[model samples]
Target: MQLAAIREARAAKVAEARRILATAETEKRSLNPAEQSAFDKFKAEITSLEADEQRATFMEDCERRALGDPVGDRSFSAVQRQVNVVEVIRAQMEGRSLSGAAAEFAQETERRTGRKAQGVFVPLSAIESRAVNTTSTAPELVPTIHRADQYIEPFRNSLLARRLGVRVLSGLSGNLSIPKHGTGTTVGWVAENAALPTGDMSFDGVTLAPKHAGGITEQSRQLIMQSSPDIEQLVRDDLSFMLAQAIDSALIKGGGTNEPVGVLSTSGIQTASLATLSWQNVLAMLQKLDIVNASAANIVASTKAKAKLAGTLKAAGIAGYILEGGKVGDLPAYFSNQVAEKTGTPNTGRVIAGDWSQVMLGIWSEVDILVNPYAEGAYSKGNVLIRAMATVDAAVRHPEAFVVADDLAI
Candidate 1:
């Protein structure tokens, strides 16, 4: 009834051909003209139907998910979906099969270019929440009309780059390379009959590949078992926060190994040095981006940088603050606690401003989650270990489009 029918028909034809050969062998005779004709006909059908077996099967299975999800209103069908994060944690804690939607999504994920889920597959959509509160201690309940129970999203960073119109490439497979034209061919006027100037253009590529950024937390098995929305919300938020932070952090601070290269470490970007937080220093960062014809769009800054800019005046006893109403003058800005204060000799925090559109965020997989009930010390402690991983990579379409100021001080 499904894609299986097509494969089965091909298999049946092959089986019939094998039987024809077997009968001839049993009778100690070679194939006659009629037998050969029948065998060749069966072979032709199979050859026409053949393809990469796994990919063919997956393509046949692809279809819209018209059915409602068992958990919340979100559905994970052929199209990658945003999901209710809490139900995902519950499924792993309960030690059972995933919800209908998640299970089907997971099967689809394994079938193709979707993320490779090693455990309970939570679509990254689960954590791409609207709530931006970074505080983990508070639990806020918001009403919902679609589900039997209202859903609560996890607290997460005010993720900046994506909101600022950064390019997003999702559901990708294998290594990807984007070619960039570094220089254009030159044409110049010359004397008649003289040799013309020859110029060759240089090109470069922005390479993106799968990099695993993982976060882990230990949970009380008893607490998770209670199924209290509040308890689950907190646990789910913690897990979601882990995934969210990793992705956000990788965009600012490149994950050193086995992770994407972030703005701070990516070579060829504009850099500015500031002994202290000042309007001049901030403007200088943008100026570098400007010289390269890069549009100054949004800013991603550390919470410390936000505080300093908000509190410090352009000049002592001056009338205005550098930052107001979550903006640096006309430019919209975002802050993250992970943009840490440096402990180096100068002791500064990181601030990045750029044409955020040049930042390429490639997602190879969604949030892949696994809960281990038998983790060391888990059984004795009555807890389970929860680990979530996101397969992603970051590339700068034009490194010159970004500028970093990591030496800003209070």
Candidate 2:
């Protein structure tokens, strides 16, 4: 019988035994010979059912172990018995899922967490033992593995997105606006006692709404099954880099349709026109900024523009513009290929100088991922497509804090 069926039968037998015992108690007498025989039969059936149940449970546990998975409770001991940590880590490094039992460990973790699972499931004692062994000999693998830091550039290092001031939001979407204080009535100064004129504070609303940014990555089933574990991380990093750059681009040069209004598009920001990038031009843009904004400003330009600026600095022998250690003076300089390299008839490059703090970036907390097994191209290659998407928005709180040096020689 199935486990459920067996359990149900055992329950019925237990109930019968209880009924027999209760009847004798109600009569306030020992069971008669016939009643005693009936009681004994019920007891025998319940005992047999209990043994069957135990055997079923044992069989289930054995199957779970064979599958390299933990049973219902997901306890530590159960995990330890079913997973091989070393094999799991090796599988990850190769950009492939572990076959056989090791794969089960990943599956179980993903089932519980509803996210991609990485790493192993070894006990602390086992890790300590491994550490001890590794300490005596040259470590089998270095403690750290280095990869290109692509994702960090746009969001982690971008002037507008990271260094500049921004208010972070957790929700998927919402409205945001800045308040404007009303001017108090300018009453002429009176000797000591006239009641101060009253004025009302007015608010202006700047609606903040998030737009979607996302991309899809497709890999062959054969590659997933045969490749090394680093492939997974590679895909993850690439997706993140793609989204980060997109959002960063929108923040700098977006047309303000579906995307955020970029710094270049904001009204009333200071501007400088220069035919070529020069130290004096950069300094002029800096000077045009409000003193408050200049205190915390950063410079952002395209790689081409940075190269041009560096050349000009070298020609002029301006050591200050050399950008040693990635900075020029007190301002940190960043390069983004996304910034427009040329615009208008003269084909001018652009440089943005601003206090990033005046820009606000809002994002939904989690990136939504969907795995598709039957996408059009995926079907032919026996592969799957993993698409990641996020919702975000950006707004400038004060345009006066920014200056754009456009019409620069490219």
**RMSD values, in order shown:** 19.3, 25.8
Candidate 2: stretches off by over 4 Å: 1-160, 163-166, 178-201, 225-229, 276-280, 291-294, 313-325
| TM-score, one value per model | 0.68, 0.55
Please write out the lDDT profile of model 1 over residues 1-410, one tens digit for every residue: 33444554666576568667855764589999999999999898878666544555554434322333232233234335544455666687676776556676676566557445678666675565332112222346864333313445544456655666656776678898877788888899999999888889999888999888787777765556654555545555576567776676787777597768887778888888766777887777777865775666677788878888898787788788888888886678888776767778767887888766667788888778887878889868767787888888998777887888777774
What C-alpha lDDT, on a 0 to 100 scale, does residue 134 get in candidate 2? 10
Candidate 2 least-lDDT 10 residues = 127-136
Per-prediction tally of clashes: 0, 15
The true-structure Cα RMSD of candidate 1 reads 19.3
Report the Cα lDDT for residue 54, model 1: 51
Residue 8 in model 1: shift from native, Å?
A: 39
